[model samples]
Target: MSDNWVVQNLQDILNRWNSTLSDIWTLITMSPENFQGGAIWRIVLNIHGALQAIGYSLLVLFFLVGVVKTCGTFVEMKRPEQVFRIFIRFAIAKGVITYGMELMLALLSIVQGVISTIMNSAGFGTPQDTVLPQEIIDAVEDCGFVESIPLWAITMIGGLLVTVLCFIMIFSVYGRFFRLYMYTAIAPIPLSSFAGSPTQSVGISFLKSYAAVCLEGAIIVLACVIFSVFASSPPTVNPDAAAATMVWNYIAELAFNMLILVGTVKMADRVVKEMMGL
Candidate 1:
């Protein structure tokens, strides 16, 4: 089922790309007089903007996965050695997933940008423009190119799935290690008596810190996705207008991600200190 969904999604993306390319070709061929004006520059600018969007999307994904792994390590410290091994394995798996997702997101962003640019160049109103047929506008909005409820929902679901998968994989790997930790002399102390042993306290603190970091990271990613969706909306334009709007939108997204990273780190530090009774 999952494989089928993946295949279907890929097909949908390809179809959208083909449709977009066709529109661009039609526009250029229909009126060669307009092709050399702002239309050409708009196309170029939109493509560049789309690439930038993809770049930032991947960066966000990479940071998110890192945050997840760091938190997993801290959280599993109750069975230190066992958890450590699990963390290592999970990290490897996560790296692969993150890289692939990043690549796909980038490609999708570029396709979206190209399609949107073609539409605008052909005198289509911005996706949100009330002048456009409501149904057509809505369709474009829901297509994951613009920030619509469906797109946001998909992103939320995807994040949750990834987080749940990570949790499961980590637990599975640590299950065996946990048995060994239990047999060893330095098993993690119970949470009830966590304050008595410095080592145990350190573990507890680390776990708390990790949880806080994960929470912050999750929030940041959510915010970025939301902001990106809104930012990616096509601006109302005639062929003569500059295409720099897309570039600005990309810059705004990068700024948002950076803010999230800084905030997550700060929150983690505070949570760790509090957990350790410091």
Candidate 2:
């Protein structure tokens, strides 16, 4: 078979793989929505309402605990400053419980804004193309069918690996949205801890953890942007190598780079947590 025919066949496989990655990218870069037309998001918002209702009942209990802990005796409670502080704490905590969903959404919005800014600055308006090098194409074309059998096998394996990695990366991003929904749903419970001075640490820790989850997207985006930069410069093919050797070498490095991107996305939460000391 002619080299042109061989190159075109392999090129078609590469094109399909690239197209799949591009489709997955649509899911990755977009922000999640709670008030959207989606049933899942709406259900999640309803769950948040239910949790917030329960949090309201707990709010009174938490405030009472704070009052008892802070006030030594009835005489202490008579002090103007003591009375003012407890009242202010109760009021603020009540407000938080009442507006827990809004607060969580606001937090998500802020983090998404950060992601947008990073994407804009990085100039990543679309998914990065993961194209194989022309050298690899040329090398594959020079091989006879008998020799090209292994090349086809290598390409098939590489294509499958790339597609799997694309799904894995996109799913990691989707997982972040689910985490956001969960955090929003249960926000009131943790936030109500703020009503008690002794338990305020619980609420503070919850806020920190939630922020870490939200910032995870930023880390994932950064990883993808870095990968794009690396991928822009294809691996240098050895001109003297056999066709199978060149194809193997190229696929191996490409898979490794893809693995790095997938791993980064998977570890995004941990990365953000460590960065934020959460």
The local distance difference test score of each candidate is 0.36, 0.78
- Residue 55 error for model 1, in Å? 45
| Model 1, position 258: C-alpha lDDT score | 33
Clash count of each predicted structure: 0, 0
Estimate the TM-score of every prediction. Answer: 0.22, 0.90
TM-score winner? 2
Global lDDT for candidate 2?
0.78
Lowest lDDT block of 10, candidate 1: 183-192
164-193, model 2: which lDDT tens digit per residue? 876786678678778877888788899998
Instruction: For candidate 1, report its TM-score.
Output: 0.22
Pairs of colliding residues, candidate 2? none
> lDDT score, residue 121, model 2?
95
Query: What's the CA RMSD of model 1 in angstroms?
Result: 24.4
